[model samples]
Target chain A: MRELQLSLNQTQKVRLQRALEKLESLSSKANSNASVTVADSIPVNYEDGLLKGHGTSEFNGEVVATVCGIVERVNKLVYVRALRARYKPEVGDIIVGRVIEVAPKRWRVEINYSHDAVLMLSSMNLPDGIQRRRTALDELNMRSIFEENDVICAEVRGFQHDGLHLQARSQKYGKLGRGQLLTVPPYLVKRRKQHFHHLENYGIDLIIGCNGFIWVGEHVQVTDDMVVDQVNKSEQDDAKPDENSISPEDQGKNYTRQETRENICRAANAIRVLSTLGFNITVEVITETVDLSTSINVAIHEMLGSEFYVLVAEKESVRRSMTKKK
Target chain B: MEYVSPEGLRLDGRRPMEMRQIRAEIGVVAKAAGSALFEMGNTKVIAAVYGPREVQNRSQQLNDSALVRCEYTMANFSTGDRMRKPKGDRRSTEISLVIRQTMEACIMTHLMPRSQIDIFVQVLQADGGTRSACINAASLALADAGIPMRDLVTSCSAGYLNSTPLLDLNYIEDSAGGADVTLGILPKLDKVTLLQMDAKLSVETFENVMQLAIEGCKAVATYIREVLLENTKQLEYRRGI
Candidate 1:
């Protein structure tokens, strides 16, 4: 066998690490540890507060910038580290916002921090899958699509003189009709991804707002199949209910295990898209997740067989489906 | 310049083996990925915890385990004579190394490699025993950050002066010219993680001073524990769960 390299036990490693930390610190003050910027820095500054800085330029966060020099309304960069910030959108950043106005052709969303998020009219259900200018028919269906006083999850499209554009093109990202909103110091949320499985395990949904507010909740129940099934199971336990003997309610309860599984699978899918896009229990963005998922009174073994979350279909028209009545 | 009095009492009117007040607050830096601040007498320190994020520094990443990085910095305003550089100096480097080693014993680093957990300790003020205070602060901050650790690391320093051993030496005792020993211990495990001495003491007297320092550390741990509990309760209560 080849000779193995000497390995460090825990104690030795600790000692080594300490020495290294000293070295790293020395290097850093010497301006050598040239990395550590935000996007991931504590995260709170970007998450909640409306960003205010010198004109048009977005604070570049690709690397952490030290105060090389300081003055009112502006600062100078002396040394730059990695993990810097840049303008234009990166994927997976939460933006807080509300609906400003709507038309058959398009709906405009107001993102608090960077720029307004726009929902183009033609983006919905087009053959080419590309939205163009709005039409009269879209005008008629506009309110049917969206109205005032609606808060939503939208992806940042791009930047323009008009402002930052937004799209709620996916079924997962849409109008949050119901749920309480929760706010926290943004950095904690960033650090949370450390475990990488908290969202998946907990079976929750989340919507991160760039303005630092969060919308979170369990999924909304689409149908009461579990409730209906439970009643049927209990009836069966009491007596053998033949087709004729069973009531109308009992008859509707007969969802095959596969069909029942499909329904739950759909909800779980919805939870994933929401959670994956940076939504978690940190917000009051609840809908049907809790009611339907919790309504799943199935046995533990059966639950295990089911997927953790039923992902929602990613689509631009998804948010348009939510009506004012909700 | 007497730290231990003729009556066997220390400068603060206690016995020669006495510790100054120790106070701590854990998880205080909400913006930091994790943090805690500890105060030993007039020596106050703020320790911030960050990372386990995307790993940078190719040469630094390890295949088998995570690396612990500590930076012990002194604020410009901390000492009677201002420090021009808060970090990146020999003295700070040595202290930082000691803290990192002492803390690593308790941390479960293999859980997160390629990622870094940066513990930065800034001494806001120094009355005495800055190193011991820094170690205690880092430990609480690590625990507050929810980092896995075997036990809390607590430290205290003792010195022999005028025939009596003193616990928790203040600046006066430390600079007064005597034998000084600082010990970092995992109180529950009864393990000594870091030990260093700067002056000399007789064999029997050294033992006495060491024992006094260990006791002082035990007391500091109690104070740290209370502060941590109070801080956790405050955070939990704010969450209103």
Candidate 2:
């Protein structure tokens, strides 16, 4: 009963249990009892010149685990990969976070890590797309760019003396809006080559943050129009009489259709079910779950029902077994 | 009152050195990084651990180690007689301090520098030996949170009454005005991190009682290890390759 949060009938319960058992059998063959609890000794040959890594310590000339996790060995180095813990950031990883503080020249973001990540004003590309230095006026207007409590997407720049640093250089990395943010265990979100996915069919954007903060939002065409807008504004300042026409994109900014909202909900619920089942979350699996619900004609809200959960479980079992066969 | 019968059985039908049944469940709190509910007979405690994250108070952040904070509370309905208790009472403050110090001894604080870890344990049922139950629950929560520790710390209580040494004292025995010893130990390292006794006892008798408590702790440690290992495997296998 790993996830007993849902209420299921006897038949559904049996089916789900059987599916989970199959998953257990499938995974156990690959990593048979590689787990170690606190203080359990990890067997390592002394002739290899062992180098201990995180989550390990030496006790009485024996390497013992300091956490409950799977023992991972690479060459002569031994380490434990902990699950169900806070995000441990690495450089060049894409992450989603919420701004917690607006400091003098930086915004502190809560990225599900041990420390709040700092996004300095200078590290980000300003709206004008100019390469000028950050002036005092820009410092005063930092709130206009990203104020407190704004959900942001950024990259792990590096570690600073005080805390982790984040950068938002690309237009794809910025304020995320009109969507849902789902928090799962960070381990479930494996780092990938492309974290941003725009499902062309659903007209929705799915961002899989490395910190396990998943954003499901309506797809907005990636644009750097703010720089163009700034240039046009300065030009139009002197010729204000001829600035009557507005771009079609500016007029359609907040007009998300109701159907698109439903699509967003459907996709978000799909993610919810998969995360609850502890399945590996990739774009492919998420889209497949959504498609299953749609094909079965399950309502968006009913996707969380007991029957749908059982169906998802059975489907996952079939999917994994097929992959294993290949 | 004869606490131990002629048959060498306590009031609850357990032998002098026998402990009460223990049960543990992990991930009881959805929002916490780690959570566990542990029960020792009628004494039930729930523990939640948060962070190894940024310290809430900037001034209190440690430069080279994580700051460990603990708060212990007892619900009004947990006891037989419901009584309104003030927050931060003297007894609870003392117990919190004891639990914090015992936990800090085993946690590898230096690994998470400039962060703070918060441990909150509440008594759901207060039969007796609440201190020992709280310690065991906190240890499980810490392990579930994936926080590094030197060793798992397990605690148990032993008492001397009716000219016999008893393990895991009940409320009646605990309030009997006898010598009650609460011991916490790192079972793997064979090191004692905490020991507290209220009443007086002879040297030989104290040694015997302490030994009984340590044995109880080791038993509890074995149970906890089994629970953690099972939970870890479940998580691993569920998130399959």
Candidate 3:
């Protein structure tokens, strides 16, 4: 039996096993024997002028798999879809990364790819939301926007000779703060049409980076800062409080509400449970898991408990089987 | 002292040509890109592959191929006598180099340019043939990591003891001052990537010993393939449609 890190009681274990078995049954059988280990021969019709793709190579005049994955065929092309591998980035993928280095005119972001992606200051909209050329002074003040260890979200611009380049040209793609970042296997995060979700009901935001770095945080209105500045100036006439009267912490006046904070933690723990169960992390799946926990009155921390894992597993199995029936 | 008994069995009640039972488990290390634990009898090795990611040292970055790095360590309690061996000991360093070269031969480094792959293998239990066990574990981990390779590399150690070619030698036979031949091969390609021997053997006897080791390696390769296939299937189904 495959080991689940969580310790489960006898009944929980049985439930989990049954749910997993149901999932296995629900999956299609077309590619049942298409799984290949290292160096195993992938059956193909050589008469079709085959083109070998990634995770495969020519060995002894035979197309053999070089990785443990499922064989995927499309007309004359064949490739292996590897599981449990590092993130392979494609252009225009929304990814969350952590700033590792504040270099000259560029920031090196670790996006779980083969190399640290380079985010040039010129490529992103500055805090002022202006389209001016980046000056030497702007380079000097790069840390003001993204310094070392700051978590950021951006789009994959493209690959270059130096390394991968990222662009943050939109208001929503910039520094992410006051959030919990969860790292899961990249393969589990499928590239979908929408990676950013604003959970309106909970007043929380979920950013599912294609690189498998997920961010769950309080929702921030994605408005141009320049507009906000004008609004703040007009509101200043309404008798603003004196800055010196309050402590530095209170002066910022950016404390998150208790309800929103709880929602963030709840969403983060929901993601953790989905990752532990090795299920695909999507907005629908995550919201479903969160609702499941809330309906059962599972605490945020207790969502990782053994019984909760079993329940999630069972729920997922039932959900998948229902889809299969349709 | 005779290694083979009068009934043609070895010390541990196994035939001369028999191999130890093999067991493998994948996804043992959660943080690693790929990981596996392999056991050949009492020799247990856990391997974790961290990259095909950004190179840690910029100076060592290769332009055309990914840099391959390997580290081999054994726990103090793995041996009969608990000895605190410092890091980079001569024996471990040599073994690490051997494993790296063997793995590099099979890995398609050109596909991952400007990156580095790290393989770390630790011996938890050492009955004998830790080298072979470590190689098998690394192969499984690399495959699990989805690093492209020319073929899966499998290794085994055989010895010529009491004029018999013993497959999968035990610690007793290994330390008996007989010839120990460690062989690594690409089963599908029928090519040898690593061959090392300690002590001397006659040409005829060495041929027989090498052949026996090759057979053991092929057997290990088959088992490894089965384990990897099963793991891939499980991961696919678990991820759902």
What are the models' TM-scores? 0.49, 0.96, 0.97
User: For each of the candidates, what fraction of the native contacts does it recover?
Assistant: 0.00, 0.77, 0.78
Provide the TM-score of chain A alone for each candidate, in the order shown.
0.38, 0.93, 0.94
Tens-digit lDDT string for candidate 1 (A1-326): 00112254666455534543333333334332222111111122344333333211132342221211111222232232111011124444545457778844667775533234566755443322244566675567777656776776666666655445666554455666434354444322332321111133344345555444565444433334435566666776776645557666555444234433444344344333333322322322223443344466543233322232221111111221232114
Candidate with best DockQ:
2
What lDDT is reached at residue B226 by model 2? 92
Q: Could you give candidate 1's per-residue lDDT for residues B116-223 as a string of tens digits?
A: 778999999988899999998888777566554556789999888887777888888889888889999977567899899997777898888889888988897777
Write out the backbone clash pairs for model 3: none
lDDT of 3 at B62: 93
Better of 1 and 3 by DockQ: 3
State which docking tier applies to candidate 2: medium
Residue pairs with clashing backbones, model 2 = none
lDDT of 3 by residue, B68-87 (tens): 99999999999999999999
Give the distance in Å from residue B97's predicted Cα in candidate 1 to where it truly belongs. 0.8
Please give me the DockQ of candidate 2 compared with the native complex. Answer: 0.76
Q: Which candidate would rank higher by lDDT, 1 or 3?
A: 3
